[model samples]
Structures are given as structure tokens and as C-alpha cells.
Target: MANIQWFPGHMAKALRQLRENLKVIDIVFELVDARIPEASRNPELNDAVGTKPTLLILEKSDLADPRATSAWLRYYRQHNQAAIAVDVNDRKLTGDLTKAAREVLKEQRARAAEKGIQSETVRAVVAGIPNVGKSTLLNRLVNKKVAVTGDRPGVTKKQQWLKAGKDLQLLDTPGVLWPKFEDQLVGQKLALTGAIKDSLFAKDDVALYAIKWLRKQDQLTALVDRYHVTTEDLSLSDVDLLLAITQRLGFKDDYERASERLIFDLRKGKLGRLTFELPEDSEATDNA
Candidate 1:
């Protein structure tokens, strides 16, 4: 995958700022893409937020396989981590987040009550890698256009604190990526999901990776069906698959456009609900 690596200067600053501000934050809403929960998570951020109460929110649940999302939820619960899958556009999103946050902060709430403190407001930071919908989730949580929303990464450059509910406040931070991706697959997954900038990687390379992975999961049928490819096309190599798709779609000379179309359709959920990494794979990685 050409050793993909991206770490903007602002991301480094964001990490430093988050570390400095962690003291005031009561809980961390660690947002991850439901389609790639493990890859979407920044290991450095997890380490920096160590021992703090964190609610692992799998955003964009609607774009992920429902069964896979359930498995991930169970996996987190088994590991004693509070987690929930939520679609930003869902009507019950606010309530789901509120309930999950309350559960994570139950002990903290009790301690405050013991100190004779009433009406203790919970403070949390909404954090994630770029373009994983941190800003969109914040806007949804507040039910307004408070944070700038976009389809690309690095939209929110500065941090801002906003009210979420009667007793909850949230700090919205810019999306940050680590200096390096230890695993190449992590980079590929991030790139495919639009978390990484398009200019960083070749469209055909990412599309080929997506094709190989989808083939393993038996999801290439969706691709074939989406593009109306013949049965013989399935047996073709990754590059050949793209070429065939391009030719079939009348983009004979524009292979890049064909690759982009495939990627766009996948991202837009036109193919089907897909999840890249399974719970078993993540669990093994955790042990390793």
C-alpha cells in the first residue's frame, strides 16, 4: 500500500492539547467508524486517555453490517469497556449517548453524591481520527450547527467546548492521526473509508485492496451486481477486475474514474452494509 503515513502538524498539537486538557474532562467519548472500529481507533489516543472513563461510540452504524456491529458491541462489553453503536442521523442518538455516558460515569456520580454535591455536570471530550464524524456527532448531540461539518478530514482545526445536555458538556477537538501506522492494513482501511486524504494514496491501489478484502468476505457479489459485471469477471485479478469494471461502465480510458466510482459507491453505502475487521481479528490483535 506504498507505506501510507500522514501526520499533520495540527494533529500533533491536538494530541498535546488533549493531554493537557484531560484533567478537566470527566469522560472521553472515543468515536470510531463502525465499519472499521479497530482501525479507526488511534492507539496513541487510547494510551493518552488511560484509566479515564471512556464510552466507545461506533458512529455511522447504519453504514456497517448490523451483525458485525452487534459482535463488536459484545466484544467491548466482554472486555469490560462501555461501548455503543450509533448512527448520527438516528432519532434516538442523543438518548443512546446519554444512557451510555450515565452508565460509564455511574461511580463518579456516586462519589460526587457522597461529597454532598448535587447537580454535578459531566464533562467529556469527543475525540477520533479525522473524518470519522466527530464534528457531525457533536452537531447532532447539540441539535444545532455548532461544529463545522464536512465530508473530508481536518475540518475542525481548533477546540471548542459546547453544551450537550442539562448536565453534560463536551469539548470538540480536531481529528488527529498518529505519526505512523504500525500496520499497513490500518492505513489501507483508513484510506478506503475516507479518513485519510484522497491525495495521499492512489485510487486504484485502494480500490484493489478493497476488492481483495471484499472478495475474501464474499462481498464482491455486491460489487458485481452494482456494476453489472459478468460471472467471468469475478475470477479476474484485482487489477483486471477494475479494468473490466471500467470498460463495462464506458470509462475505457479513464481507469481512475472507474476506481473512484467503485470507492464512492462503497462509501455511499450503495453496495451494501460492510464491515472491514471482525471482532475475532481485533481480539487476536489485542492479544498480540
Candidate 2:
């Protein structure tokens, strides 16, 4: 969830400030993009918070592939359910999270108890890439709008705090980025989903990334079928593919217009539900 393409000037300073604050935090809520958890994990953050108790929250889980989300939960469970998928707005989440957080913090809390420390309230840092609902999730937990919400990314420019509950506190910071992308497919996926800043990715490249995944996932074909693409031979490189999709969707215009329309439709998920990763998929891959 970390997109820092626009925050170059703030990058160094943010890192400096982040280093100073990491020591004071109790737990790191390392949020990954639910759609691409393997990609969104920030190595810089991982280095900074070295060995700190971390709750790997796969945010925006509702929009991601459910099978992938479930797989990740099992994958990270060796560290006491290190990963979890949650839709922040779900009404039952407050109670569910409280239980989960307590479980994650039990050992640390126990150590504190031995030192004659009563619970000094649970302080957690909610951090992830831009636009993954870090601020929105914080607001929902406390039932208040403590930060700005926007369709655009990188909106929160400063660190803020929200009282998640009587004993739970959320520390909000600007989104962070890893040093570089080790996986190119991850980069493309980010751009295609509007996860990366528009300036950082070429529009056509993003479109192709969308096509790459959408073409293979059956659920994504609803838009393709609507757009009238003759899926006789699905080709990601075919420039006319968008035209077919758009026309099938009933656009009364040239292929260019249809392509543009299809792009919008793809971004908004007119395609059906898809969980990009399944537990079996990961397990099978791991076994291989």
C-alpha cells in the first residue's frame, strides 16, 4: 500500500522522523495491499521496526481476491496470526480487532505486567502505502473522522493520532515506500489498480497490466464480454482488445472510445469477483 512517487522531497525527512519514532511504538500495524500483499510489504519499514511485534493487516480485503487473503493468513500464522484480512468498515470489526490485537500483544503485555506496569493503553501505528484506507480505517475504528479521505493517493501529509478506543490508540503517518521494486509484475499490478501515482506509470502500461490479470481471471471477463471482445484467442498485446470489450459493453463509438471506456470499467471492477491468490495456490507453489 505504500506509494511514495510524489513524496520525494518528504522521503528523507520522513525516514529520519520515522526512525526517531519507531522506538516509542508498541506494535507495528504493517498493512499490505490486500490485492497484492507480497508486493506492498515495505522493506524499509521492516528494517526500521526490526523484530518488533507486527500485525500484518491486509487492508481493503473486500476488494481483493479472497482466496489469496486466506492463503496469506495461514502463511503468516506461524508468528501468531501475523497476517489478517479485514474490511475496515465492517460493523463487527471493532470487537474482532480488539481480540486479535490482544492476542498479538499477549506476550509483550505479560512482560509489562511483570514490571509492575498496568496496561498503559495499547498504542499501535497504522501504516501502509497511500490510499489503502489507513486514515479511513482509523476513523472507522473510533467512529470519527480524524483524517482526510480522498480518491487520490498520498493525502495524509503528517502524523496524527486517533483514539481507537478507551485503551487503543492509532498513530497515523504518511504512506511509505520500499527502496525499489524487486518484482516487476508487482509494479505493474500496482499501477494498473491505481495504487501507484499516475505520474509514475504509463497509462498504456497500466492498461496492459490490467489486461494481463483480467484476461486470465474468469471473473474479469464480464467486462470483456460486455465490451464485445471476441475471446477466440485472448491476447494481452492486442491493441484492438479494448475496442472489442468496449463495443460489447455497448459503446456506440470507435475502438479508441471503447478502449478508454473499458479501462475505466476495469478499474472500477465491473468484472466479477476474483481472489487472485488461494491457500492451495500458495501451498502448491511453496511445495513446488
RMSD of each: 1.3, 3.7
- Model 1 poorest 10 in a row by lDDT: 117-126
Question: Candidate 1: misplaced stretches above 4 Å?
Answer: none
* Candidate 2 structure lDDT: 0.67
Evaluated at residue 61, the lDDT of candidate 2 is: 80
What TM-score, over all chains together, does every model reach?
A: 0.96, 0.84
Query: Largest lDDT belongs to which candidate?
Result: 1
Model 2: per-residue lDDT, tens digit, 9-104?
Answer: 565565666667777778888877777676676767878777777888888787776776776787778535467788887897666666677788
Candidate 1 vs. true structure, TM-score: 0.96
| Cα RMSD, model 2 | 3.7
Quote the lDDT for 175 in model 2.
77
Backbone clash total for model 1 is 0
